[model samples]
Structures are given as C-alpha cells and as structure tokens.
Target: MSTYSNDVFLVGTLYGQSAVSVSQILSGAGANVSSTALLGAVLNEYNARLNDPAVQNAADWYSSYRLPTHQEIIENYNEVAALSPTEQLAIGKLGKLTSYPVMIDLGPGNVQLFTAIGLLNDYKARYPNSDPLNLKSYENDYSALAADLTDTFSDTTVKFAGLMVQKGTEWGSNNVANWNDLSQAEKNAFAVFFYKVGENEMNARLESAGGNYVPDLAGAPIAQEFYSNIEGIDSAVVNSFGSWWSNALGSEQGFAEAQKLEYYADFFEQNPEAFSTNPMFLNHLISEVGHDGLRQLANVFDWPLCFAEGTLISLGDGTQIPIEDVRIGDVVTSYESTLPLGRLQNKRVTRLFKNEVAHLLDVHGLKVTPGHVTLCGDGQFAGKHVPIIDILLSDGALVRENGDLIRMAINKPVGSREDQFVQVSYAVDADAAREGNLQSGKMRVGTLLFDRDDQPVSVLDCIQAEGMTFNPKTGLVTRAGGSPEPLYFFGELPRPEDYILRRSRETLEGILTDGEWEGTPSQLVGQRLRQTYSLKLH
Candidate 1:
C-alpha cells in the first residue's frame, strides 16, 4: 500500500458567495428544505402575513414555491436508505434543526427503521451526556455516533472507518475553509464528517455488484490516497484496509507470495554458504521461491548447488565426472587444501535414503572410505585407506556381511562399551573391490575387551587395546594354539564431537568467503540457516 498526505485548505467559497451569505441564502430557501415542521412554520408565517395585509406580496413567493412530489420524497428517502450508516446518522442529526422528528419509514417489510432506532438508543445510552437535539453537539460527538452506526451496520468499510475516527486524535479536510484556524475539537469533528462521506462513497463502489473493491497494483495509489488522507489513523488499520482491498481484487495472496520470493533473494545475497553445509535448507528455500525461484537465485549467486537425480563433480585436477561414473581406485584431486595436491585415497558409497549427514556423523560413526568425498567442489573428507572391517567397526558405516547389511547401533552412546561379540561376514561389491568386479572376503569377528556401555568410546579406546590380532579383509580373530591371550574390543566409537565442531567452523568460513559479506562472524549457524532459507515477507 502507498502512503499519502491530506490536502489542506485555509479559505473556501460556496456557490460564488462567502460562507455567511451562502448559509443565510440556504436558510431562506424554503422550497429546498425537506422538514415537515419547517414547512408548517413557513405556511403559518404566510397565513399571518396574508391576514395582516401590510405584508404585501408575501404570499406571491410562497404561492410559486411547490412542495416536492411524493415520488421525489420517496426517492430522497431511498437515497438516505442507500447511504452508509454514518452518513445516515449525520443526516438524521440535521433533522433535529427543523424541530421535525423525521421517521425513517423504510416502507412496509423493511426492518431498517427499527434497526436504526435501536442503534441510536444504544448510542444515547453509551453517551448519555451528549446532546441529541443540537446539530453542533451531534457533530462534536460524531466519533461516538459513528462508532454506534458502525457496530449496527453490515458494511465492513464503514465499520473500519468508524473505528479509525473513534481512535484518531486529529482530523481535517482539504475542502474545509480556514482549516488551520479551526480548533482541535472542530478539526476532529470535520475529519469525522469527511471520513464518513468518503467511506460511504468508497463503500458504494466497493460493495457494488461488479465493484473493484480488491485493488491491484494500479489501485495502490488509490488505496494510498484513501488511507493517507485519514489523519491519525493507525498504520495497522491502513494495512488491514489494503489487505482487504487487495483480497477483494484477488491479488493479496499472490502479492504476499511474491514478497516472500523477494525476501529469499535478498537472504541469499546476504548469506551464501548457508545452502552448502545444510542440505535441508533447500527444502524451505524451494517452498518459498519454488524450483524456478531457486534456479534464479542459484544463477544470480553462482551457487554450486543442484537437486537433480545425478550430480557431476569437478576434481582438483580439472577432471569433471559424474558421481555415478566414479569407480574405486580412480584418482581425484582433494579439496581439503589448495597448496598441496591430494589424491583420492579411499572411496565408498554408504547409501543414505532419508538420513541427514550431520545426524549420521554424530549418532553413528561415519565410515571413512579410501577415496575423498567432495561436495559442490568443497572437500568434505580427505581419502584415507582403512580396512573394510575398521570402517564398519570404527567409522560406524553399515557393513555387508553374509549377504546381509549390518546396521549400526545408533542408540548406543559413542563411548559406550558392549561385551557382546556379534559374528558377521564381510563382503565387497564389484565397484568397491580393488580390481575385481565383485569380491567376497568373509571373516568371523568377536569382541574380546569391550568398552563400557554407559559412555561413548573414543579413538583412545582403540589405541589402548592390547593383544588383539584381526584380519582386515575378514574380521577374523586368531590366538596362538593353547596360548592364554588377553584381547579387548572397543564398544561404541568415540562421538564425533570435535568433527562436528570443525564442520560448523568450516561452514561459517565458507559463508564468509562465498559472498561480499563484511559482517562480524557469528556462531548462530542455525539462526542464520533459518533466515537464509525461510521466505522473506514485506
């Protein structure tokens, strides 16, 4: 919605005459008046002048003045009926001037008359001290009157405007004469009147059968003008009107969604690495901007991210290959350090269907393969050759043994030790073997000395083990014939608390290096992640 200022006038003329002259002329315009009591008083004056005979030609002007026809009167009544409740009340207050108690006869079967009477009674009850007989008093108490009318009316705009006027402190009009000279109370009164008129007219158009109540982009200026001219109205009230107007025009939701998209765009500009470390962040980003919006943001920021079925990664040696095309023993440059070129040492694909990388690393020991793992050109892990059994037992990677994949005991604490010795076979797929297409090297594994089951065990536990000999290909434990040997098995591996901390630090560093960010560093990665991924609202 747009904002605007009210136009103020210092002096004004009516019908090419001064205010006093116009008021005097209107006071004597008997034919223009609609009050029955005023008409009767005029007739009484005419009769008195005729009987005196000294007042010659007094009846001449009265004779030429014709009362409005019944049809015209009915039309006028209908016009009043069509007016907003605030306007109707304003006009009703004017009826008191002629000492004529005008009954709002809405014809037969119309309950509007009763409804208006009930509302007026309630209004009088609320403001018992307010004068109902005087027009100036009525004008002064317009806020209360408008509030009552608004409560009694079905029209939402009138209800809204009435609420604003009641809550507002100052009011004025562009059409009022000597606006600056008017007292605060008078100005407020004028503001209430002006609002009633404008609201009535605007509501008429808005409530019409084919009204343009819901504003589009083009209607923003109109909304701005309408809302801005109302002095002292709450900003929230103005926004509510704009929301209603836009909803009526069928643009509110669309505009809001567009605003979210713009917000995400700005977020990406401010925080770049947020998308790299946290993959789930993409879900929220996708929801706000949609696939196309994500694509647009990615392009604008040169984000090395993709959500396709397959991904192609570039090696440090400038070799670009699809992840699916990568095979065991194939050398790839490492992204861990830029100074010295590092080769892919270990490679393993532990398929994760719905698991988060962080959760897997923290709860379960992550397997370190012989080859490095690079994500979006960032080195996630430097390859290091480790036995398959060591990878399964130490790194907590799922192991395939005896035609069954051995799942990690995720519930077990990292430093916890278990005395149970579970036996399993070790099998390697064709892609995972050193040379062959497929290989099966089975071994029997048993726990000799295990860590306690209460706490997480660390690499220190493995270093402290004594008198244990096991085959790397097949986890087979051997003891010298008839020799008494003491062997210990480490229970759950050490929790990757340090690794997690390092990853968090790296994520922040990536964020700082990704964009033109000059802000102070923050440890609030989750907060930054939420801001970066969530929709931006206006």
Candidate 2:
C-alpha cells in the first residue's frame, strides 16, 4: 500500500485554535510543531485544565469513590459522550485516572508502557494546573496520583492501557503494534513514538518517562540513511540509542543484525566502493547525528564549537581538525539553544588543513556530473550563509554577471580524502564552473528528478530531457508535468547535480538557507541562474 494513507484518527487531534488542523499540514511541518511550539501550548492547556476547580473536584471524588473498574470507566465515558465534545474531554480525566489504576494491575510490557507514557505526558502538557488552583497544591496531588499508579501497577502496561482508554479516539486509530520490545530502529521505522509520565506531576512533567524512554528512532542507524534524505531529525545527539532495542530484541547478535542488516542489504545492492568510502559512511554518519542531533550532542558534551558562526560549510570527515577532534558522530548545538541544528546546517570536518582550496559550484546554472556532492558556499546577506561544495568536474565553467564564459578550475579533487582545510570558498564564476579552462576539462550538465520509487532523482545527459514547471502565483507554466523543460547547460557536467540543484534552488534560496546567498558580498552565480530559468515544482 502507498505510505500516504488518509487516517486522521491515527495521527491524533486538531486541538485548539490554529490556522489549520494538524492533519492538514505536511508531516514535516506537523512533526516540527508537535515537537516544538505546540509542546509548550499543550503543556499550558493541560496545566489550565488541572487548575479548574470543577475538574479537580471531579478528580478528587473519582479518586475517593472506590477505584473504578475498567467497565465502570467505560460507563463513565458513555455518560460523558452524551455531552459536548469539550465536555467529554473534560470528564475524560476521570476515565484516565481509572484506566491507569487498572493498567498497573495488568503489568504490561515496554510497548504498552511506552504508549502510556506518551499519553500521560500529553495529558499533563494539556492540563498544566487546576487554577486559582495553587500550582504547588495541584502539583503535589498530581505527583501523589502518579506515584499511586506507578506503585500499584509495578508493570508499565497499566499506563498504556489507560492511554488507550482515555485517548483511544486519537491513538487507538493508528495500527500500533506491541513491537515485542524491538530495537529503536524498528520502532522509529514503524513510526512508534512513546514516552513515560507519572499519573500526575508538575514541573517538566512532559519529559520522557522512566524505563519508558525508547531510543529515539531519529537517532537509529536506519533513520540516518532513508529518513534523513526525506526528513530532518534532531542532529544534536550522536545516537547512543539507549537500551530500548537491545533489551527488547534480546541477544547481542539480534541487536547487531537489526542495526547492520538493513545497511548490508544496501551494500549488496550497490556493490560499488560507495559503501566503504569514508564519504559514503560520512553521509550515513551525518544522517546518524544529523545537524540537530549533533548540535544537541555538542551541547550535551559541552563542546566549544558552534554552527551558527557564519556561512554553512562542509568539512569532510577527518578533514576538519577542530571539529573532528571533538568526535565523529557527536552533534553540536547552535549558539543559542540546546536543540540540534539539522544536517544542512551541520558540518562534518572531512579535511582540516589550512590554505586548502575550496570550490563552490552553482550546479543549478552549469552542467554537473551524476554524483557530485555540494556544500555551503561562502557569501553572506541578511544574516545567513549559503552552500559551497567542491564540484566533481575538474574543468567546469560558469557564467558571470556580464554573461561572459569564465574558465573554472578544480580547487580540490572530487571525493578526495586528504589532510586539508577547505574554507568557505565561492564557486568559481558560474561561467567558469560550467565550461573548462586551459587547465581543467570540459563541464557537463545534468538533470534532477526522483525515479518511480521517490528516491532522489539525478540524471546526467539531461541537456535534452523533456520536463515541465509550474507557478502558483502567476498560474503560468500550469500545463502537465508541473516542472519546466527545455533547460540549458553551460559546462562539463558535475556528478549528482539534480538533488543539489533542487535543494539549493528551492529551500536553500529562502526556506532553508534564509536567502543568505541572495545579493551577498560574493554573489552566487548559480542561484542567479536558477532564479532566471528554473521554475518551482513544489
């Protein structure tokens, strides 16, 4: 089945007043809000709910009136169902309390507990305090209640069952499996998010639950490869995924197989040295730590380095001494916060020698090979930096502002793993990078598009490929394929220019790079070309 199934209930609710419901937004946006700003909103709401004298009274009565059985909780829910949805959610707290007590009796395992913890934290974040309800008093009561549930149940399943009973309408819809306590990778690949929480507590109650903390799936090795290409993850932590999968999968061999097996499958499929090359693994490693995770890890490790210093730069593994000396898989935080900066913003030091020549190729304008890796280029405007990476073509040419063809030289070799520091260098003049100089060879043009499976699409010899483009603002170019065609090239094609072009042309220009390279001290000739010819598809 296509991964794009329409199941609102499985995804959770559209709580409160927002421009649009949670379901309407793309998953990337959804995950961002859910994990960031919305987390604060939910926490505030839950605190307010607890403060309401009516809910407190009700909770107090329910707690005192002989622990309600699972059946009794259901009947209470039925009664609440007759009320408005808002009323039902209010009265639902009573059911939530009862459910946890029973879950304790059941003694459930990791999966069950994991789910429960997420629910409880969600609840707490939604209902911060019982108000004019002394925050402290409510906190004390919440803590006691949480302790009671934790103490009585002993097994975490009690909380899981409670989550189902209370928030079943939202969570129950997802095809959540028990996972048999598998690896963090399995849970993440499967989209199983869980956290633990006490029945009640205040002050950082939203933190990950005890024994309930699963290795962040975003941190798993599998996620580094597949998901990183498509989704951004917390890059502030080198994935020490904890014991979630190890304990669940059981046996050292099982853990190793779970982690490495998927990778081995790819190795066999693409037997080229790409699998063993340091850059190949560094790509995966970058995926593993991600800019965000690495930043966070750096914060955790208290590294002195920061990613927001200036322009976004790429340092090949072991090439960046100051950065690599710290750790290969560690995540460094941005200067301001402890959160990860994500991969695009994150740089891995592949080489570390000073006085090293760096080339920033504007792939969008010139011909590029089928597999050239681009990095952040030097140029700053409006307080942000842009991408500058070494183009694979030895002799590529680029276009200049006067439209003159400038000969491009290869400052650095493609996929060269030597001891050197490539600084923030601008791509040779666009015309230079496109065509060949006396020293460098001819430049080739390439196309970017995903194949049938939605993998990153890169095609060389795209000088004649038919395509389409669209414009939402003008409604022009609204024909069929939605991507414009009849593209032109300037020089020797660099390897893998499509993705780099697509990313740079779309998000980096504004969305991701924040227009840092637009009209900067070092004008980006390639970006200039994209603005002139390339049309937006998304």
Candidate 3:
C-alpha cells in the first residue's frame, strides 16, 4: 500500500515456505558482511519481531530499487562499487541506518485506541466510585464487562493496548504533573491498562491459519515488568520499530547493546540536530564507542592515518617496534590533543587496506604515502594534510650543500631570498616544457587538469589516474594502472631522465642551486643508488 521512493528489493532464495532476504536491509551489517549464514540468523530474530518489526528510521539499513542476484554475497561482498552514495553509507559503515518510505497503516486499530479510551471515560462518569483498577481482572461482573470489549478485531490479543495509550495521552494532556507526579496506586491503575493480552493458543493459531493474525487470542495476566518493557511503544514508536528491521535487518547481544547505548539514546534523542547535520557522526565514532564502552565489541578504527613500513610504533613500555610488527592488545602511544605527551592505550586493528601508492614521498629517511596524514603538523582537521613533497621543498626544509641555510622563494631566482621562505604554485607546465616533453599543443589543452582553490589549475606532477578533481567526493581519482610516472628526456618518447631544468628555475632551483643532486640518467651498472634509494627508470 506504501509507494516507497527508494524501492528496496528483498531478492533472496526461498528456504521452503520461509524466505531469506539480503542483509543490506539491516544496519550494522557492515560491508565486510560474510556468510549468508549470518543473514539467516539476522532474519530469524528479525522475523520474530513478527507483529511490529521496526520503529521508523530507528534501525539502520541499505535500501535500493533493484536487488542484485550476485551470488558473491553468499560468501563475500564488497560490491560497493556499484551502489549509490546513500546505499554505500549503509553498507560500508555501521550505525548509519537510512530511512525509506516503509510505513504501517494500522488498519482497524487506528481509531480503536481513541474509541476504547472514550468508552472507559464514559463508564467512569456513569459509575463515579467504581475505579478502573476494580476492573483490572475479568472477575465477578468485571468478567462480563471485559468480554463485551474483547472481540476478534479489538483488544482480545493485546489487552488494554488501547486503554494504555488512552491513559498515557490523557494524563499528559490533563495533568500539570508528569508520570513522577502520579501516586503509586494511580500509577498501578495505568499499569492495569497494559497486560500480556495473549495465550499459548495464539502461536498455534498462527501455524494453523497460515496467516499473520490470530482471532480468538486467549488472555493471560502479564507480569509487572512487561508493562515497563512495552512502555511508550505506541503507533509512532511501533512504526519506528517496524522500519529499522527492514532498514538494517541487523547486531550484538540485545541486553549488552541496550545497556551500552542507554545513555547515548537519552542524549541523541534530545539533541537530534547533532545527527541532522552529518548522519554518519555516530557511524564514524562507533569504533570509539566500542573501545570505550564495551571492550567485548571489538574496537577497530580504519585509520587512513598510516605510517611507512619501517617506521616505528612506540609501545607503552617505552620500547619501539616496527609498525608492521605491532599487534592488537599492544598498548601504543595514541596522542590526545589535550596532552602534550601522549597517553598509551591498547588499539585493535579492524581492517588493513593494501596501499601500494604511486605518490610516495621520503620524509627525512622515512618512506610514506603522499596521502598520509602524519606528515602534517598537529591541530589540523582530519584529512586536511599537506603532501610530504611540499614540506621538503620549503625553504627551511632544504639546507645548502655547505650545511648553510638558504631562503628558497620559488618565484625568485633559485638561491636568493632575505629570510628562509619559499612559494609554491600548482601550475607546472614550465617544468614539463623545459624538459621539451610538452609536445605540439600539449601545453595546457592536451593533458589532464585539476581545480585548485576552486579555480582550474594543473598539478606539478602528472597523475597516472584517469579522473582528476580537487575534492574526491565528487569524482574520486581512479588510477588506470600502467607506469606510475612515465620516463621522459629531450622530448623523446620513453627516453632517459637526461633533459629539462633551465626554464623552471622556480621549482627546481632549490636542488639545482645547492648542486648536490644529479642531472643525468643512471648508468646500466650493478646498481645506481640515487639518494640512498634505487632509481629504476621504466
């Protein structure tokens, strides 16, 4: 009956009369979701919430128009490559459940709640002294009265369901005082409006009828705790509950997660704008929550903040080990901006993405990815990083061959500046032209371009990637894998690096002024060590 805009598919195999849909329907089922076996388990509990599944938008899930019958999901699935940004968020991260237009109509039960409430109020007015509590059980004359109200379509299943909604709605509307204002007996009177409302025969009815509902549900007295458990789960809340199931047919021991997120639920419920800005905030911090709140939940943060292979990862014991050698449960020195000296904490590794990056830079003697964040100084926002190459070419970064300091203003001649300062530019067509690599009409129009500072500009070095953009959110650069950096010399095809340097006095002058680096290709000898590293011309 509901026409969902984002038409979510439940493409799954039928296990006899039972059906098992894809796990993307649930939040907390991360991208690394392995085993359709887990899907079965998730759906088992999900289907158990048979009556009212999700609270609208409460649970997390990835919804899409068409379902891929990609059998790859049976064992492994990283097919986020083909998903929309919203669907990607649902799959790639945890805690970020997306909402679709899945809704409940409530059918006959919609106005039934108000009707029951009105009937109870009229009865109270007729018999002024007969308290509602007196009719708590179907005993004596009350039995006949309760039977009159109990029918197939009404409160036979969930006894007092409408009455509880009535009392809650009325109490809030009429009384100045809240639930805390109610006396103990008065609170018990409201409790009398909520009960189990079903019997063991109801389960048998579901099996025999082969349908969703049970008509003649036998009544049973509910425990005191059951009222509190089902508290506040009205139509709105029930709708929310119904939505999350389809949203992320998803996580964890129920009690443990409930206890952990109890305080969080309170805070976020009040301050919803925190999530309204960036819905992924909680999803991003989910690892931190696991580490801080529940150690059993496996803390793993995919830190794009990487270190080079040989770099040292300091241990809490004051000893150092290579970054690759570090293991989970090892207390490593993790920095907190509040403390000048960082504190040591145990960190666990969740994922390890192999980055054989083309743009590698040598920071001092350490080899690091140009994208690495540790290259930047502290206090910078995450991902706001400067390439290591930028720092090395700066004035203070480079020393003269005689060990003397020199200001390296790229705009001026190579070796002349008052104080140690340098300027850099994104335009580097001159660098390529000086080498005579800029063939006919290849100056600016023939090559790839980038939007620097919102203005279109060229990169100093050419990227082997196909797509180029200032911000990756729009068009992520994907390398078309051939050579990382093609070799050029004397404007010849695939020549050695033996040409170009004269006109580009701005960028190259720092190294050329010092005259400490080479200006020609390496000889085909045993090994040509270039600046403590091998320069294999491809």
Candidate 4:
C-alpha cells in the first residue's frame, strides 16, 4: 500500500473560535472503505464537531498509549508516540493552568492595585454584606446568577511597572516619581494604565518569580528580556516608555501609550520564537483587542525580524558581516552596555534554526523580524534563546518622537505567520547559551514555522528537507505513512499533579517505559469547556 493509503492520521478538532479546523487528519480506512469514504469520514467528523465548544487547539504533540488488548496487531512501529528532548523539557517547565472557572489565575489575574481596589470598593458598595474577593460569587455571575465578582492580583502586582516606568528628565520628572517616591494613587495609576493596555503577562512572572526560575512556557519570560533590551539599547529610550504618563491619573486613555499592547500586535502576527502562535497569549489578546482591532494594527506587524537573503548581520560595533557567512561559534555585537566604560559587548551564538514570515519590517532600510526572539537580544529573562511575544506586554522597540516613546507598530502592514512567499529563514536572537553572562547575542533573522508538519521549510543553503509535522495551534497530528486503523495509539496525559510532579521524576529515573509526558496542551481546551461552559463531551 502507498504511504498515503494505509497510513493513519489521528485527527482531533476541538479548537476555539477562529482556530484551524478540518485541516484534514484521516486515520480510519478499513479494507472496505474507499478513498472517497475516508475523505467523507474526515469531513463528516469535523462538521459534526464544528460547534463542539470542546474542540482542542492543534499544537499538542504529546506521546501516546496503546490499549493492552490491541498492542500486538500492528508490528514494527513503536508502541507509543515519541517526543524530542526539548519538547519534554518544555512540558515540565512551561505547563500551567489552562482551564479555569472564574478562579484566580495568578498569571493574567494579577491586576493593578488601583483597579483591584476600585473594583473591590465598587463591589462592596453594590453588596454590603459580601466578600469582595469571593470566587463563588464570580462563578455564579459567570453563569448568569446574581453575584458579580472578579479575580485578584497579588498586591505586589504593578510594583515592577512602577519601577520600570521612570521620568527620564525634567519633562515628566516633576510629575512622576521614582517607584519608591510615588504616592498611593500614582502607584494605582501605573497599575491601572498598564492593565488598560492589555495583559502584559510578564508582570506576574518577573514580579514574584524567584531566583530558581528557568526557561518557562510560551511568552512567560518576555518581560525580563524586554526590560533588558530597552535598558541596554539606550537609557533615554527607556524613559520614553513612561514619559507620557506625567503624573496624570490613568484613565481608559492617557497612559504611556508608548509600550501599548497595540504595537505588539505585529509581534503576535509573527508569533515570535513560538513554533506556532502562542495560544494562551493569543487568546488573551483576542479577548481584549478583538479580531478586527488586531487585524487593523499595521504598525510593527510589517517588520518581521526575519531578514531577506544576503543581508548582513550588524554587530553592536561598526563591523557588519553577511549573516550566512557567520557560523554557530562566531561572536557578534549584540546590544549596548554602560558598564566598564560604556561599550557594546560581543557574544557567541549557540543555537540556530531556520524561520519564516510573510513580510519583513524595513525600518529605515534595516529589515528584521518584529518582537521575535527579543529574549536573545534582551537577556534579562531565562532561556537558551527565545523571543517573548507577551513580554511583559508584547515587548516593543520604540523610537523617541517629541520626547515620548512611539509604539514601534506605527507605519506597518499586517501579515501572518502562516504566509509562505520565501523560506530561506534563520532566527538570530540575543541568547545566553553556555555563556553565563546576560545579553548574550543579537536578534538576527531566521526561520521557524508555526506548522505541525514539514510545511515547506527553506534551508539557508537553499536546500529543502522533509520533516515530521505537528500543529501547535490545535495539537493536530498527521502522517502519510503509518499503520492503518486500530493501529493509532497516543499517550494520554495524566492529571495535572501527576504529570507535573511524578512523571518528571519518573522520566529522570528511567521509569518512562511509555514517555515522560502523556497529554497535550490542547487538552486543556476541553478542560476549559467542561468547567466554564457546563459543556459535556463524553
């Protein structure tokens, strides 16, 4: 039988709204089933599940498990699906709560103190005999009962925002005070303004994350990297981020529009270092900005960090070399530094990969990816190398205009991480691989597609290779060659505690007869459906 004939494609189509559905994964083709039947089966199954609120995202690639009774039928192939070491490590470090029922999520739940307080006070006045922070009340309200409630942020939330936002000069200096000097309302103002823009996601991680933090889940480490990049690039630019606030009490408008989440919409378009778009951050932005608003942002969206063929990698120093001419071990100028007599430092590149994007941002003839691998250039975060799409709030690169930071998104056209005009892509980031020091490398153009399978990868040497496929968006898996029906097997992820705790140790102890992790991140979408929507799947 041909690879496409007998090969099985296990398909799961439980994606959220605006998600990829029916991309086609047909696994069942009994001897009696025709090619038309197989096609119809896949389409019929997808249409049946089209409205199933429980549809999962397509990015999950967890290992699989074969039922004991059916294990002997299929031969030669391994008993379970396989996972890469990096993917294994990613699960342990990056995994967190995916589904919630109005419960407090310390991640995006961290709100500005002022907003929290104001909302709390409002809630209290509405219901004098109630607890303002009650989770049950919120759950009821979510179900359309009566009590209105919301999540809580660690009081420590927004303190970092205060510190990061500073009045660079007399321009906003008289009005804005250093974090310590800021009054109560001013502190709330900072938090209010920050949250108004959108979830910076990084605030919680960088604020409470202790010293032992490592490379974490998608978009987690972005805040630290963004802060580092702006600080390294120029102190004055850092000031521009907050110069607009000017002691003004924050409202829906009039905050530091400089680092606004609007600009990073472009960064989201590229999906940064993510294999596909970061689902968690993507969902959050959609909730706040809406699809049309995000679609309308033309700013930094035009500038993909990916450079075109034959572009030279610019060093912090004056020298420039053809990017392809640079090798893995070579050192390049990354970013600016003020210590040791104020000079730029050279750093080594550790990991390199091919990446792709639909469009490239040309800022004054300097082409690059927008917000991709910003982590590498800005080493304030944990990781070998990566760009934090939800940095602190989709970390941005701004230019000073009228002494205020202009959102880097200006004058950009919208694009997609899914587009494929050119493929010779390679990602260059400021990385700290093997190098203990921070600010390790520079952001250079490169390639990584948000595709599940070998979706047309272009090599720098102008070669193309067939590669395995998995979509990060929906945890969808497919193959042209594999055992037929009843032959498909998958490792089901255990409960949160089990996989996160015991499985990690078991993998280290060689107890993983099957695999280290079992479930896909996309499974959480179903979990979310069960809890929030009162929906039933099985």
Q: Judged by TM-score, which candidate is best?
A: 3
Once model 4 is optimally superposed onto the true structure by TM-score, how far is the C-alpha of residue 346 displaced, in angstroms?
0.8
Each prediction's TM-score versus the true structure: 0.22, 0.19, 0.24, 0.21
Instruction: List, residue by residue over 384-452, the lDDT tens digit for candidate 2.
Output: 222232221222332222223332332222222211111111233476545532122222222245456
The candidate 3 region of ten consecutive residues with least summed lDDT is 517-526
Residue lDDT tens for model 3, 382-432? 111233333322221222222333222121122332121111122225677
Task: Rank by lDDT, highest first.
Answer: 1, 2, 3, 4
TM-score, ranked from best to worst: 3, 1, 4, 2
For model 3, the local distance difference test gives 0.28
Q: Would you list the C-alpha lDDT of every candidate in the order shown? A: 0.31, 0.29, 0.28, 0.27
Candidate 1 stretches with Cα past 4 Å from truth are: 1-253, 256-260, 271-284, 302-321, 324-395, 398-478, 488-538
TM-score of 4: 0.21
Using lDDT as the measure, which candidate wins? 1
Q: For each candidate, C-alpha RMSD in Å?
A: 31.3, 23.7, 24.4, 28.3
